[model samples]
Target: MRRLIGAAVVGLGIELVVLPLWLLPRSPAWGLLLIPLTLLTTPFWSLLHEAIHGSLVRDRRANDAWGRVLAIGYGAPFALLKSGHLLHHRYSRTERERTEIYATGRWASHAPGYYLRLFGGLYLAEVASVLLALLPERGWAALVRRTDRPDTITGLLFDRVRRRFLTQFRLDASAVVAVHLAAFLAYGRYGWMLVAALAGRGLLISLADNAYHYGTRLDASLEALNLRLPRPLETFVLAFNLHSVHHRHPGLPWHELRTAFAADGDEFHDDWFAAVGKQLRGPLPAGTLIASSPGVRRH
Candidate 1:
């Protein structure tokens, strides 16, 4: 509970209070603030991730309530973020969710899309998806019909988009849009600072999202890189650097991840930054790296 509240206060405080004050002066120094603010995203996201997995609190309602608040501050609806993440756990390394691999004879055409998604476009797409909440029920059904495929992430997502879920999605998305819009208005002439900060957040998140699973075996549903980090830094990010443990025990809270890793005799695949850096080598041909077994292995 303390962690959840602390995360909420710090994350929302930076977005709502600190950012507006920095921009109010309209000074060149505003750019300097972006670095630390951007770096703070990892911990903020870690806490939000706890809520998504229903481990932020004991009560389901309270968990989702906190998740919605954090997700709004993060600039996307909670439902959207939760749905996408759960889908990643379900479809990871499959054709639909493998962000760093390309099919034969298609690397050239897909390269632009892959790079865009890796840098900042993924978060931008998440934020922009709020617009879909404006569509009527019939419209959503039509969209599902047009885009759904059994093997694709979108299909699975749309399959779960019943009326109750859609209602909740619309409500949370409205809150997201309203909060950010008000933040921009508050920033006024210095709104560009907010824009830069969001872009930086997006870049950081997109780059890190795939680092855990990049080039891992496609057949292993729960495989992930357990990247090493300095102890202090790992604690700060809520032990999220221990990604393989989280994949194996999705219901475990952030506080328990380190112990779980130790108990399982897990090993780190690489330093966190080194694993993230590997992504810059660009998309690899599908099946370029193969694992002999279904459990965790370094790519």
Candidate 2:
């Protein structure tokens, strides 16, 4: 969580510092800063993503409790994210149900209008997804399974949050609306800074990550990476890009991913890259999908 907090501080502070500068009437410089700062949010969202998955916390509930705080900032539903992500882990490459690979031919990735969605104005996108996830008995049923632990905190966690969101948003459950509301109160047309810079950059990060990690590989384990980012870039994405180690030991928690990688750097450096070499841009290694760990069960 410390790593995530640090990234959030920087990612958000960049905006907080500039917003005040902009209140002084039209300043081109503030707008300029806003343009790129929005770009950085993609990475910011990436950091939030890993943190929500419990990597940031040594304790699961400790991680989970605060995960909602993160979700609230995004105006996102934790249940929605959890429902999809768990499905991704369960069936990373399966068709129709694959969140990673949108075989919907939407592969013509990121464009300008796509970026405008940072305005917190994209309606029905996520709502449709959450609803569709409930359409199949698989979707409805798996979502229900989360409630099996009635004796524990998970019950209150899922039901309360989900019910509150369901009642509040109804069919119009876009975090974008809250974003717009904040924008109206905060800065009018320019208030999009929060969404554009923060969420826009966030979407960029997700697309890049999705394509780099998911869009390319048909196989799950082969796509894993000890993704060593360049030094300065680490501040933007945090260490969350080091994805492979986390998968190897999901129970190991977030703080330990780097330590675990450090302990095995030599081995991953020597062999792991080539193992995943098939998924890269230029090179095409001829082979079937393979994961280094025989340990991960398909769910």
Assess each prediction's global lDDT (C-alpha) against the native. 0.82, 0.46
lDDT of 1 by residue, 1-299 (tens): 66556756676776666767664566656557657867888888998898889988899998899888888889988888888899888888776777787766667777887789899988999999899888988888888788786446885676565444888888888998888888888777778878888998999899999999887887576878999999999998989999989999999998899999889998998999999989887888876767466566654
State the lDDT at 191 in candidate 1: 80
Q: Which 10 consecutive positions of candidate 1 have the poorest summed lDDT?
A: 155-164
Give candidate 1's error at residue 97 in angstroms: 2.0
Candidate 2 backbone collisions, by pair? 38-197, 41-201, 41-202, 42-201, 42-202, 55-254
The TM-scores, one per candidate, come to 0.92, 0.57
- How many steric overlaps are in each model, in order? 0, 6
Deviating ranges (above 4 Å) for candidate 1: 18-34, 162-164, 291-294
lDDT of 2 by residue, 105-180 (tens): 3333522333333233232244233343234435434555765452223334344335544433332334434543
Which stretches in model 2 have alpha-carbon errors above 4 Å? 2-28, 57-62, 96-124, 127-176, 191-199, 212-223, 253-255, 265-299
Structure candidate 1, residue pairs in collision: none
